[model samples]
Structure formats: structure tokens, C-alpha cells
Target: MAETSETSAAAGDAGAEGTEDTGIDPAIFSQLLPFDPFDPAFHADPYAVYRKIREQGPVTRTPLGLVVVPGHAGVSAVLRDNRFGWGDGATVAEHFSEAPDGTTVRPFIFMDPPDHTRIRGLVGQAFSARRVDALRARAGELVTELIDKAVAAADGGPVDLIDAVAHPLPAILLGELIGVPPEKHERFRALSTDIAHGLDPSLFLTPEEVTRRDSARAELYEYFGRLAEERRAAPAGDLISELVTAEDTDGGLTGHELVVTLTLLLSAGFALTVNLIGNGMYALLQHPGQLAWLREHPEDVPAAVEEMLRYDPPGQMISRVALADAEVEGVPVAAGEQVMLMIGAASRDPEVYEDPDALVLSRPAGRNLGFGLGVHFCVGAPIARLAAQVAVAKLAALDLELETATPPRAPYIITRGLRELPVRLTAAD
Candidate 1:
């Protein structure tokens, strides 16, 4: 998504207070500071604030002149609109360079059409529907293996589901997909988490986090680079190898495009999937009726997966910059303005779905911006859906009682999901 001048200015003002003379509402400014994108508290529970913004209007201008699109229709409109441009590396550098260390991180997913088109097209072939469906058997096998280990570890005792299943399953899957060695999984997993956290702007990091992020980036680039080189020499079955040889009308991705594309796929590929599984499990356990229903009719697994995504999406929101001056949901937004599309809030908008707050597995499948919309829709969506279907099916089949220690939510806002989900299982006699 593109970042607008309004958003950059608002974010630049960070913790400052606004006055009537400044043409900014004090309440709006207060909400903006406390709800910084990186704040853990915001991640824990943002629905209330989302509600507030939604009721205020579909589009509301902030003290910093940035517009916030909160309602279901409003958020959906932004996602579906083509006029908004995805910002480039320079934009990211401008927004994040204010940090103490002043290092810039660029992932190709953040670029505009032609560039995004070229990069995404190269990697897109690997995540084709057929390829993802073909992996279902493997995905199910992996889930079963992880579940077996979890059941054994439980031994009539409690198990931290996140550590045993939630984290490792997707990590292993992504690793295998990218051809990372089994032995290097643990190291790479740790690095991925740290780097993901570093991307959060609200998490005030010490110099240590800065150093770790830089190091992680270097290591990841080097690792993927070597793998890409090997793929060039002799292609393999993995995604990297496929990208190394992929071609589009324009041409194949360059070395830099390949690196950036791989980086984004690696970061997004596992983190959100793990969260989807973990969060979906937690939700089902909390609502046992839904759990039992899913278990009783395995045929409903696909619908259940969609409901899970709509109910508590792994990605809370996405940003876009206005390519031209446009009025969104009646609010006038100038060109180069930044708009935040609240996907989570939009899914829960009562107008879009009946009982937006309630989780209904059988609800008619309406459009969901959860995977995004328009040309920038998530490329990994098919694979993610297949993986989730396999995961939820296996989970529903198990004879288990979910014991929630605490409501699960990540400490970061952009990618939201369960940190840890603890549960108990009763072995089949």
C-alpha cells in the first residue's frame, strides 16, 4: 500500500498534542499516539478503537491531515480502488529513516505496478492453485506429524500449542518450500521472528534490535542469494529455483527483484499462516459449538476456514497512497495522502454481514478484503487457504479440550495473531 503525505506528517508528529488552532481534534490526536502501529496494547485489542473510528464516519481526517478509512464499505472501497499507488523504497526510507540508526529496509511487495507486476509475476507461478492443491497431502501429513508430537508431549498434561504445533508446522513447511535444510530451521525461525519485529515502528528498539535486524537482513539475503545461484546452475523443485527461471512478457526478475520477492514471501509465507492456525484453533475452542459442528461435518471445513479468516484476520490492516486527489467515503483526500484500510474492522461491519461480531461458519461467502483486493491482492492466498483447510480439518478431528491461558494476540499490530495457545488432548482409547 502507498503512504500519503498526510500519514507521513502524522506519523512524524508521533507523540505531539494538537490544539483547536492547529485544526486537529485533541481526541483524534490522542487516539493516534496511543494507537501507534507498533504498540503492543493496540495489538492486544484494537476493535474498540476501530468501532469508534467507524461510527465517526467512513472516512475521517486525522490531526496530521491523513485520512483513516474505518467502516466496512469504506475500507473495502480503498482496497478495490486502482487509483492508489503502492509506495516504493524511497517512500519507506523517508518514513522509517528517522530511526536512530537510519537503515532502510525494502521488500518488493511495497513497490508500484510495473515493478510489482514483474516481481509478483515471477514468484506467482510457484503459488498457483494447482500447485497449492497438490501440496494438500503433504500439508496434511505435516500437520499430523506435528499433532502426534504434540499429543505425545501432552502425556495427559498441558501443552503450549504455539511452541509445539503453531510455530513449527508452518516454519517447517515454508522451509521445505524454500529448500532450507532441516538443521538450519531453528536458526532461521529465530531470525525471521526478530526481523519481523524490527519492521514494527512502534516497538522502541534498543541498538541491539537495530543490529539484529541488519544482521538478519544480510544473512537472509546471503542465504537466498546462494540458493538462487544454485538454482541458476541447476533448477530445483523449490520456489526460489522456479523464480530463477520464471519469465513474463516483460522478462524475468532481476537479481534485486528476486531478492526482494523472496524476502517478502519468506516473511509473509509462514508468519500469517501460523497465526491463522493458532488463532482459528483458539476461536474454535472458545466456541465449542462451532468446534463440534466442524468435527461432525468435515465437509464444512472450507467454509469454516473462510469464517475464521473473516472473523479474526492475521493481517489487521494495509496502507495505500492516493495517486490522485480523491474523496473517499465523502472525505476529501489530496494526492499523496496516506490512507489506512482497516481490514479487520471492515470484516466486522454490520452492513456487510449480519451480526458482524458473531462468528457464523455458514454465512454466505461475500467479498473479503482480508487477502486484499484489486491488482495487489495477496499472491500467496491460494496456498494459504489450502494450508488452513488442511490444518483446521486435522485439528477438528482430534479429541481435544482447548484450555486458553489468555486471549491470544501478537505484540505487533500489522500482523496480528495468537502468541501462545495452550490446550489439552484426550487420546483415543
Candidate 2:
């Protein structure tokens, strides 16, 4: 990787032979600088803003020293490139905090290889494709049960889909897999929401937000720590118990690692999947033609799920730090510089797919940075796909008549989804 001069004279000229300038308009970057992505206004309709950034080109450098990769190729490259490090705490300090404790919250998903490899290796077996498939039938049964309940309660009136279906489907499935008691699901949901909401720096005071997050983390750690202990004493059929007893001949996970893995799975699992269901459903309702097509051909559900991920991903952006001087799409980045990959924009880039904005299930499956790429790709992706597939399939099967209780957008930049989607349902003839 090489550094290049940032000047108009050098901008148009190709700096490196193999690398091409992303040719992003500098003005677009200036526009988004003042607008916080987590603002309610932005979330209400981020696609308009995303369109402006994507049209400008693939990459732009923000005033905040963060490079925003908007198009498919540029975003994909950053995600796949190993020169970028995911777990650099120094970048967190630069962007969000300066506290020592902030540096100590080591999420395994943030680590580079060897460290990442070791941790992922320990937990990968549990999320393997076969294991995920084995659970799909049971997952579908849960989805059917929930939808039946929703229909029963509708009574020709609007039903809050988030509460009745979208939220609970994944929550219940994940709870069962992790061995969380049914009664504790509500607590887990609240805690996860608190932790996610606290991620936006503009929303809360640094100290207050940090404290809230740390407290939530502590509660999770304590709860899972106890669960791990119980599992160790008397193993069960659930994931936590299996993890407790797992060994590699050399040795098993330490208490700390076990707890962190549980924390990662529990926190990352349901929230994103819930958003996937919510976002996917909202997209379908907006495009009634697609909704009808799905109803006519339920077999297309899997492709519909993929389209949802590409059109409006559950995650909007992911961050990484440069491990060394790197030239990405002609932008000069030094070691420790933070890069923000705009997944929402990238998924809609015309370069990667035709008519990127329109929801076309017939479109051939294309590469997407939705689950990310490289070593740090989402570990729970299999379970997420299964959960979303089941939820969407069941929902499409219903004769749905949707109504917005309160406009369907959540105020968050990191995760893209609806806060609520109320709908009136009737059984299909």
C-alpha cells in the first residue's frame, strides 16, 4: 500500500497503475458532515441521502478523518482487504472516546487474524451451516405459530407487527438456542436495545452513554457467567452448555473467553435478525407487486431474502483501521486512520447490479458486502438467514394489509431498520 498526495492537480491523474481513483465528488462529503445519521429525519428516508453519496463515486474522505466507501467495488475492497485491522482500539478512542475502559471492551469480531482465527475457531462449529439447517424446521414451526397468533388477534384491526411477529420470532429462536428462559426474553430485548442505542455518540453524553453501555455489558456478562457455570456443572442440550464442555485436546476456553463469546452471540444475534425481518417486510409492503409475486411463488422466498439484504441491509456501516500506510481507490490513508464502509450505499451501486434501486427478485444473485467480507464476516450469518427466511415466508403467506402506526423508520446509523410496522391482516382466500 502507498500514500498519495491529496490535491486537485494529482486527483484526476491516475496515481497508481492497478488502482483507480474512486472519483467521488468532494461536495457530497461536505453535505453529510453536519447531518447525524442517527437523527430521526435521516432514518425516515436514508435512501435519498444514500443515493447522493453513491452517485458521487465509490469513496469519499469525511472531515472527521474517516473514509466513507459508498459504492460496491470500493466498499467490497475495504471489507476484503487484510491490510485493514478490525480490532484497533486506538481508532475507537479517536472517534468516540479517550477513556481507558473503552479500550478494554475487546470484542472478538474486531480482532485481526490469529486472534480472530482462534476465537472464531472455538465458536464456529456451533454456527456451521449444517447446524443452522438442522434448526430450520423448528424455526419455521415457530414462525407459523407466531403468524397464527397474529392473525387470531388481528380481528380485522391493525396489529403491531414488530411486537406480534418480527421481534419475537428471532428472540424466541435465539432464546431457545442459548437456553435463555422464556420469561427472561423481555429483559434481554431491553438490554440489547439500550446497548445499541448507546452506540451513537450524538445521542448521549459520553460518560452517561459509556456508563449505560458498560452496565448493560456487565449485566450480560454476569448473567452469561452464571449460565456458563451451571452448564459446566451439569451440561444440557443448549449451545451454552455445549460451549462449556467443548475442548480442543490442548485445552478448553477460559471462563473469560466463554463469557465473551456468549456476550457476542447474544448481543449480535437477535437484534440484527429482528431488523432483517422488519426491514424486509417493510420493503415488501412498499412494493406490492413484489409482495404479490412472493405470495404467488412462495419458493422465491430465499431470493427475496437476499434482495432484502442488498436493498436495505440491517447494518448500514462497519468500521476498520488501517494497519499501515494504504492507498485505497487513490485515497491516501495512514496507519491508524479509521475507515467507514457504507454498506447501504454499496449494496445499491449500479456498477455491481442492474437497476440497483428497484426490488427485482428475478435479478441474478450478485456479490454483496451485506454480511461483510474477509476474516471478520458476521459469524451468525447462517442463523440470521434461516430466521429471516422463515419469518418472511410465513408473513408473505398471510393476506396482509399493512398500516403505519408511526412511520416505519428507526433512528440509528449503524443499524438500518424500522422501529415499528403496524399492519392489519386477514386470512388469504
Candidate 3:
């Protein structure tokens, strides 16, 4: 979830829109603004800034009139509401494009009703919970294999868990699930990283990075287009085959739609699961007592995973445009307005969670905006959760210690993940 060009550009146009739209003085707008997205300190600890935003009341306005919803209730409301979406593509047009063949190439997650409803409905049939749950046993097996290989390669030295497990686990599973050949998993992972970084708001990307991101997306589209054709000629048991068959249904996904959808599923799913595993492991290491509790109560690992998502979600911000004049938890929003739903901030809102800042492994599972809610909810959530649950559960059994108290954070803010989580591991004496 990168900011659409309109919202990102709004930051530049804020001076003019500030007084004209919201009657807020441009000079004092900086004081009213949320944490600086570019600051490394903010990346390390955005919760502090989230707390400050919460103090400003549930909904705050950015200088350019983009609405900021930091409260859990308000954020959830907008997500579940019908009136807010990527309407007319004015807000997120950067992410959506016209394919060279002149077909619309927007991810369904960014589309408004009717279009979104149709594609998601078809996608859901293939991405069912039953289908996803079938992978748990295999996921566990893969995690065990990955961890053993990591520890053996470490040879008692520090290993970067992210490099060893978090990144590879999802890439491998998604490859298997999406019909990508095992030989190409590494290539998929590399492309996923480029696209994931590109997914950050352009404000945060260097020109070189932007070029890489665009190039990666183009390559992936071409790769999937070829794969879709193969699956069409001879359908397989993977998700791609199921999606290909879906094209036969009336008003079903076109060839271009299939490619973009798979791209979204693979890239977004990879980034989300990787961060969930990386962030969950880091949180558990930071809170050893909770880690120990989870080890003793292994059945509670599912609940613990939920807590991890709430504590530090992978997708930090979700962008939406008000399709029509709407009210979010009583605040009136004009039509065509852009809203920034701070998932990180909403998840930790004190009004929703007790000791919002603390990580409690046993904290009862409740709704968190991590995977979002309503129709636009993550279609690949079940698979992502399964991958992370297996990865985290497998790693928790080991004798692990963080090599550094503060590991470096990923440069991109959208996917709040570590570049690498270096750690020491050994067999229990």
C-alpha cells in the first residue's frame, strides 16, 4: 500500500489546499502533521508517532486535506464502508495502468465495487480457507527443512533469520501454490523484493529504485502471462489453473486481469508473510517471557500469531478514496477525498486494546486492521498466516538470541519489516 500519486502529490500541493479546503494554516501544518515517514528513527519506532496521532483525536487532517484515521474504530469503519474505495483511480492511478494490449491492469484490491466484487468473488473460490488449510502440514515440513539448513549453514555462528527463513519460506510456498516451478523460486523472490520496494509511495523511492520496481513489474507480468497460457493449455492443481478455468465463466477475468491478479497475489503475499514472520520473531525475542510462554503452550501459537499481527503489522498503511460523501465514525468526509488508514496506529489504539503498547502473547484474538476488513480484506491472508505460523512456531523451539538489540529496518515503510534479523542459535544443552 503505497500512497496513490494524488495523495503523495497532495503533500506538495498542501500549501494551496490547506487554507482553501480545511482552513488550517500552512505554517502550522507541520506541527499538526504525523511523524515524518522519511526519518529512520520514525521507522524504528513508529508507535510513538502513532501515539501522538491518537492524541490529536480519532481523525486528523493532513496539510493537503488528506484525512488521517488513527483510531481503531474509525479506521475499521472506513474499511468496511461501501462509500470509500479507489474510486475513479484518481488516488491510486500510479499503481494501476493500461496494459500495452489496451486492457485495464488494476489489482482488484484497488478497484471499486462491481469490478472488485466480480474479480474477488472469482478469486475467493480458488483461494478458499479449505484450500489454504491443506498446506499447513506441508508448510510445517518446509519450515523444518529451512530452519535445519539455516542452522547447519550457520555452523554455530550468527545467522540472519530473515535471509535464512522468513524470505524463503513464503517464496517457496507461494511458488508451489501459484504454479511457479521450484527452479524459479529464487527469481520470484528477487522480483518480489523489487516490486515490494516499488510499492512504497514514490516520495520514499529513489529514481534508480523506481526504475527497478517498474522493470520488475514488467518482467513479472510477462512471466505470468506465459504461465497463464501454459496453465490454459494444460491446467494443473495450482491456483493459476483454477484462475484460468475461471475465465470461462460469464464476465470472468480476462487474460490481463489474470496476470495482474497473480502478480498481486505473489508479490503482496510474499512481502506480507515475510514481514509477519520477521516481525513476530523479533517481538518474541524482545519479550523472552512471552516467547517462553508460547513454547510451553504451543497450541496457543495461532493466538500468538494474531497478537503479532496486531502488535506490528506488515502492511502499515491502507489508502482509500471517498467515492461519495461519507461519514466515518461520525466525521463527515466530502466526496473525492483521500483517506489514510494507519493500520499500525489503529492496531495499537488504546481504546481498542488494553496496554496497547505491550506485547501480550495471550491477548485474546480480536479484530485488527492488519489484514484489513470487509470485501477488500486480503484474499491471500489464510496462506500468509499459515506460512508465518509454521515459520514462527518452528523457530521458537530453538535456542535463539538476537545479535543486536536493534536490527536495521527495511527502507520502505509500507511493509514494516527488517532487512535482516541476525541472531545466534544453538541446540539446547
- Number of the top-ranking candidate, with TM-score as the measure: 3
- TM accuracy, model 1: 0.86
Kindly report which residue stretches of model 3 are placed more than 4 angstroms away from their true locations once superposed: 6-33, 201-204, 247-249
On residues 272-354, what C-alpha lDDT tens digit does candidate 1 reach at each position? 77778777888788787888788778898988988988888887767788888887877778887777777878878877889
Query: How many pairs of residues collide in each model?
Result: 4, 1, 0
lDDT of 3 by residue, 188-240 (tens): 88998887666644543456657888888889889999999999899988999
Pairs with steric clashes in candidate 3:
none
Off by over 4 Å in 1: 1-45, 87-90, 94-106
After superposing candidate 2 on the true structure, give the runs of residues whose Cα lies further than 4 Å from its correct spot.
1-41, 93-105, 201-212
CA-lDDT, candidates in order: 0.69, 0.69, 0.81
- Candidates 1 and 3: which is better by TM-score? 3
Q: Clashes in model 1: which pairs?
A: 2-320, 2-321, 4-337, 4-338
lDDT winner, 1 or 3: 3
